[model samples]
Target: MKNFSTKALALVLWSVIFSFGGCAVMDKNIPGWSQYRNPDKVNELQLASSSIGEGNPVLLIHGFGASSYSWRHIIAPLAQKYRVITIDLKGFGESPKPRDDLYSVYEQARLVRNFILENDLQNVHIIGHSYGGGVALVTSVYLAASHPNLQNSLVLMDSIAYPQDLPDFVEVLATPGLGPLIIYAIPNTIQVKSLLKKVYFNDALIPQSAIDHYAGNLDKPNAKYATLTTARQMLPTDLQQFSNNYASLTIPTLIIWSKDDEIVPLEIGERLHADLPNSKMVVLNDVGHAIQEEQPSLLLPYLQQFLDAGTHRTAPNSK
Candidate 1:
């Protein structure tokens, strides 16, 4: 009986150790446990999440060919203040690449709207980079007309909205019967290497691990078609100006641009600031378009400062 009792105590001790030392044990299998584990499993529409603190909310929308995973380094840190929601946009990253016939900018806006509705958030602030910025702009217009009560502030980070000539690579990709076929022929490795060169001002700054993750999904089954279609749909439009439909949005808008941005260029970001009545611009020097990724430390704090300022109070119909 004494031996049995002793063994029982030992068993309980081991159990306690297992519970308390979970991190140590899990550390051994961290890679398997990581969100990146099931790369084979479609990370579609996944929300890479962390607490947005106690306030309205802030949603971070990633750029083209990137996922919410791009914001992984940011999720926890930003959660310290406002609730941060970063989602893999439709047809990019892990989101479902449904047929273009079905998905439009309107539908993309709906994806955002649904996320907002499902979460039951109000007075939301959306920050978008690259194409995602355009989506946010379009979303602002839609919400102003349809769901004005759910006011949202726009933060455009080098978004492409106006009818600027498409980037040369995109232009080639858009050429009839030539782009898709050509893209299909190039091996993903070569394609990825080329894309990295074009997108980054300092290609050496982008890690191969990041490239692997992006390339892994970017060339997935339906992504190219969907991307082409979305681009084509918005090529000739005053999408940013559609917000003018709402008398005066009066929502505080912040547009940040990288003076050195090679991708979208500074002109578009500046133009967005010019068109939006209640908007301001911040141009960072020596930093290319993808400021969030290129210089997160310098970029994020500035954004946080914007959020914390009195600017958030600029509601159109204020109490």
Candidate 2:
């Protein structure tokens, strides 16, 4: 979770993939294969993603515990207007999880930049939700500073941008002795699954299959440690600072917040819009922090419009 410095910062602080047992740990009950069978031929899912359309480039960034799958609803429609790309940040999903102290927002930003460069993606638009929003902001600053003229637009969805300090809940959750145990029991997949009910305004938005898809990835070899270490070491305030650095960007920007968000409040979104010189804010009424899921129909068209039309317009009644 990432956000600006404020009382609501504590609120936003709250927040994968299904991989089978490894070659050695495969279940023995399966038909004829050995108990320990290779899960599949694939190991590390590259940063590059499946694409759609041939127009402008759009990168979709998923929030905490969510993999490329989180963009399921948006990708198809977004593909109608532009090339849509979704990636699993290093520590989450099928992506490579190198546990050699390699997890950080900068590292993730670097990886994404490298991917964009590797693919020669230009005039790219970043659309991120929650934790991914922080990464998107970092990517924008890094790309604007280093690559210049790469980022064309930014869409931050109920994200954590400016960080004041640790919230009381997180402080207690991160306590020394207890933190380890909590971290151990609640791995990436499980942590996300457990939080899903509260994360989405409507629990029905997340089906049982979705929960399974997320929790299943926790078994991936180094996945657990990668997520925990990143949290303990990579402070979000570091990423939030990147926003201040991007105040001069010429890229058109859009900020979307949910009025009823229990997680990141509208204040963070509003502050971000205020701080960013080239940006607009769209707040959705009757929704939570996870506005996309709580109200996908509300966000989808606006996103499609922004990407296709390159203009920001409120839904008039969004409030």
Candidate 3:
């Protein structure tokens, strides 16, 4: 009887540790995590966000596996002229990554729309990269009827606006049992570096800081689960239906694509440009899918001109 009781206690202890361990949040100590975390919860989730400057609001969204850190280079400059807000989509960055299997693009867009409404952001411009671009597109569609002026313009950089084959990493993550094991086998730094190489046109330009920033807290089991779940549900069930709706969006849009973006491909950008009623597409040579990280300087003039044409010019006093 004594031996049985001891075994039962040991089993319970192991179960408790495993359950808690699997549910740990992404490490909040990642550089800039505290600096950008939003105190207010949008819906029920405490989203990580940074808001700076003051004018017509410009919200920036990062891609899959990225935090607000992805816009680190351009946020300051944009904030100088506009109220720049960058958010980590649910399950990414400092945002709460609940194991709740609800990381769809539509769900992400819903959160973004609420964030805009909750903050009372007006005459907003949305900029999204890769997966975030898809969210931005969906958000724009959602905003068209009720808050047209609020979401006035859009800027998409190598965005995932249309259906396409999944990237190698995405495919691997979307796999059932084997996916998690494969990703977990590699060290976080190594995994991040490997993925970065695939996105950046010139691997030589990849920095150590980038590797460290993106690799933050990925070792946690929740992070892995969130990533896997996101990959599996990256595309909506009615993607063609959604793509058909792109033509209905009349907002002024700037679609920037890298000539060497093997991930989403330049042809998709061309197709997206053709679909939108009012959109201008720019294709830059030699950059990869991460055009923001690679050639932000090249993007500034276009961004400044586009925003100046449509948005309020007066930037309010700094906060």
**Candidate of highest lDDT:** 3
Write one digit per residue (lDDT tens) for candidate 3, span 181-215.
Answer: 65565567767877888899999989899999888
All candidates in order of TM-score, best leading:
3, 2, 1
lDDT of each: 0.64, 0.65, 0.78
Question: What C-alpha lDDT, on a 0 to 100 scale, does residue 271 get in candidate 3?
Answer: 88
State which candidate has the highest TM-score.
3
Off by over 4 Å in 2: 1-48, 165-173, 186-190, 234-241, 311-319
True-vs-predicted CA distance for residue 295, candidate 1, Å = 1.3
> How many clashing pairs does model 1 include?
6
Candidate 1 per-residue lDDT over residues 216-297, each given as its tens digit: 8756889887666554454424333453443355677888887877678788776666666677788888666677776688
Worst 10 residues of 2 by lDDT: 17-26
State how far residue 177 of model 1 sits from its true place (Å).
1.7
- What C-alpha lDDT does candidate 1 achieve relative to the native structure? 0.64
Instruction: Give Cα distance to truth, residue 207, candidate 2, Å.
Output: 1.3
Alpha-carbon error at 126 in model 2, in Å?
1.0
Candidate 3 backbone collisions, by pair: none
